[model samples]
Target chain A: MDQTSSSFVGFAGLASKNKEATKMKAKRRKKISGADLAFRICNGIFMVLFVIITLYPVLNTLAVSLNDGTDALRGGIYLFPRVFTWKNYETVLSKDNLITGAFITVARTVIGTLLALVMNAILAFIVSRKNFIFAKPVSLFWVITMYVNGGLIPTFLLFKSLGLTNSFAVYVIPGMVSAFNMLVIRTYMRGIPDSLEESAQLDGAGYTTIFLKIISPLCKPVYATVALFVAVGQWNSWFDAMLYNRMASQYTTLQYELMKLLSSVSNQSSSAEAMKNAGEGSVTPTSVRAAATIITMLPIICIYPFLQRYFVTGLTLGGVKE
Target chain B: MKTKAINMVDLKRQKVLIFWAAAITIYGIIFNYLPLAGWLMAFQNYKPVTGLLHSQFVGLAKFKLLFSDVSFLRVIRNTLAMGVINLAVTFFMAILFAILLNEMASKGGKKVVQTISYLPHFLSWIIVTGILHDALSGTGIINTLLLHFGAVTQPINFFAHEKYFWPIVAFANVWKETGWNAIIYLAAITSIDPSLYEAAAIDGAGRWAKIKHVTLPGIKPTIMILLLMNVGNVLNAGFEIQYLLGNGLVQNVSQTIDIYVLKWGISQGDYSIGTAAGIFKSVVAIVLIVICNHLAKKHGEERLF
Candidate 1:
């Protein structure tokens, strides 16, 4: 098996070496050729298009958010702010839940990712052991889940029975171990030659010690991959928050916060007669919408470039495997 | 006496197996695989107040009521149509990308294209739909491009129109997922003995011939297994995007089994009805997977089971 893996390993190693050597070898030479120029232009176009696609709403909403509320509704805003004003941001910031909701979202994502990694890693490592006689059945048990489900109603009822409906534990516990993620980690772990572990055992390390010092250290790439998946999952999790966390006052994840704020305003606009009867100020909801969107996305947008290297590493590793 | 002692040692070695059974069985019972019993609710006039025992058992009544309901059928139709369209488009795009990307000469360029493309897979549908709502609006970029090319004088109402909803949803889904999906096929393609490609090339084969004969054949099993696996998710027409992006104008076309469950089960307190719908969906999904797996086995391809 190692021999089979060696050829690809050698090829990748050589390619990396060539890349470094080329930088030294052609220190004075320009990197561009005719084809390279065309490719660079193509890549530049693609990169611009990709970024715009990614931040289309961010740019639009920024414009709308910066525009005066009346101007926003009059459809004067386009790619840029028209009659720029920060009143929308001011209003949304001063509102009841935005700041607190942001904190709640951050806490959930951080804490949930940590808990998920610990539990998922332990379970995955135990299952990944070649000597574990029950690994096959255990793996099959988890795999069976990818095919069928208990359905939403029963799962909700189960959560209710477990008293997870109103608590913070509900956010993380039910989803701590995703079978697909476990399988990914396990497969990657399997690729680690058993002999490396056998040699470690010869050095007198027990299962737990070997797992902690040897396996865990060696599984850094897989750990990073798992961490990324878990973090992303936790960051965007609102369906659970919406489903179980009623009393909209309790815990509002950012996604849930945006949905609540946006949907409520939309719903309110439909019942404008009711709003008029209530004598609330006529706030241009579109301004608030843009401001709220910006608030919800700003953290992710800020974090994307920082996490992007890890994202690429994790993705390439996963992609190279089945 | 030594044989008996050796047998005892083997029994101790199997201790972890027992632990695995104990742990996973509990997990299977608690979180997954166990919600299956919720199918009972589908037959009962379930009331949370009454609990499970006291609910009136009415066989096929929920199914009958669901069948009779016009909205349910419409939701099913929309679900199937969108599901099929998405599968078709995503599969096509994924295959095209896998082939095109493999043909690229610059390894650095291939990596860059892939990395940029896979970024959307990390985004929540809330964000993706937010982007779409802006991009598909009356004066959005899509409309701007259309008008720039003299395609239309007026901006098209994309999100509101039912006719446009499926295509928009398909396009967004394909954009988000095709890159990620293509990677598996690409990996399979890469693993094909390069000697085969060499052999094909030596026989006066062009790029297309090598791709057709060598690359496609190399990944066919992966394709089949993935096909079998994906058929199981035919009813999952992506709830978040459809739910969040959909307005009253397109609600009739946007509601799926998952969305229906959310509405009737969670929102309206019709838990039994929702469970029935969910159970029905799961059953169909499982059946399709089994059928596909069986077909794959018959054709001498890899089968999941």
Candidate 2:
């Protein structure tokens, strides 16, 4: 098993070396032929077009969301707003439900991520320890869940029986330990020199102390990556909110509220009622929905660039390093 | 006697580790294994009032009903068709994107394009679908552009067209995931030997030949492993996009097995049928995985397990 696992690590090592070599070779290239020039031009053109395709939708939404809703309906607003207004954003921000939903989203992200990280880290430490008696079985117990699950309804039923439905605990408890992430963290922890832990153990440190003092600090990269995954997952998760807190309006997350709002607004706009309600504010369903998209997406977009550096490392290590 | 004392201390130390393991064990049992136990609801004629204990054991009846139901059959067809479209388009595009991106000369340009492209992956499905909805609406930019280009006589409500839903979903998926997925393939491409490309160039091969002979072959293993793993996810036709974008008009095309389960099992209170449908999906998933793993082993490729 160790041999097989090490072989997988060999794949990543070779891949990273090749990446470095490719980058170096790109820098050392001497000349460009006509065909190569053409390919480069075409590739550049394709990438520009790809960028536009990926970016235009986002920019269009921003433009529309910033524009006056009534003006936006006249159409042809592609990249920039003709008549800029803050009313759409104002309406979205002013909504009591949305404000509360934002609070819920933030709270869930922080608390749920912390809980999951601590528990999973503790579990990962134990399973990665070579001397632990139940290490193999514990690892197998969690890993098996990755392939087989009792389906959504059974899980829902279990949550219901546990009185976890329609409560905030539903968000944090059911996701307390992720087998996949535990394995990733465990893999990372195993790479830490055994001498580090042994030295700590000689100082009268227990597993818990070594885990907190010796292991956790050294495993920062994996922790940050796992935390990002957990945070984003909790923040963006609306299905759980839809299922578990359908009746508990107070517990609604931002994404779930936005989802509900979008559907309801669309449903109403098609009817005569929404048109009648249009005079109450400058916010149309279209603009509000656009604004909601930006509002929901802004935090992720803001944080993603700084965190983007971690993604390749995290994905490579977590995915291929085993 | 001294060795025995040392052994006793080691056991005591191991006990401290066991204490931590015990907590996780209980959590695994409750969250993971307990759900497996809940699979019994599929076999029972389940009702909330009777609960699992008292529910009548009507084995396979719910599954029988599922196959007999026309809508459920349509749902299955829709799921498989969309899954295939999604798998094909995303798989091809990611590889193509990786190869194209790899061929680029400038590091700064590649980095900028990659960062911009991966933005959509982090956004929630709701946001992605919202962007899609705005882009594909009747008066949306796509129809507007199509009209300007004389492709269509009038605006097309993309979501309303049942036949277009699968392709629309596929395009949305490609738009969202292609860049992120390309990262792995790009890594695989990078791992390919530069000397192979040099050898191809020495043989008087042009850029295309070099790509065909070296780059593609280099990334073949990565593609195969990814493709095999994706085959196991054929039933995950997606829930968020379908649930969000779908209306009554496109129900036939948009309703996946998950939607069916949610509708029948929870909303409609036919727990047994819902659980049966869920079981069917899981069984298909497990079987696909096993088959793919076997095939990968035979071919000497990486098996996920």
Among these predictions, the greatest DockQ belongs to: 2
The local distance difference test score of each candidate is 0.73, 0.85
lDDT of 2 at A91: 90
If scored against the real structure, what TM-score would every candidate get?
0.82, 0.92
Stretches > 4 Å off in candidate 1: A1-70, A74-93, A264-284, A298-322, B1-25, B104-110, B145-154, B189-201
Report the lDDT tens digits of candidate 2 across residue range A57-103.
99999999999987777778999998999999999898888998999
The model with the greatest TM-score is 2
Each candidate's number of clashing pairs is 0, 0
Cα lDDT, model 2, residue A206? 87
For residues A69-152, write the lDDT of model 1, one tens digit per residue.
655555536679877777778887877677767777788888888877776677777788766666677777777777778888
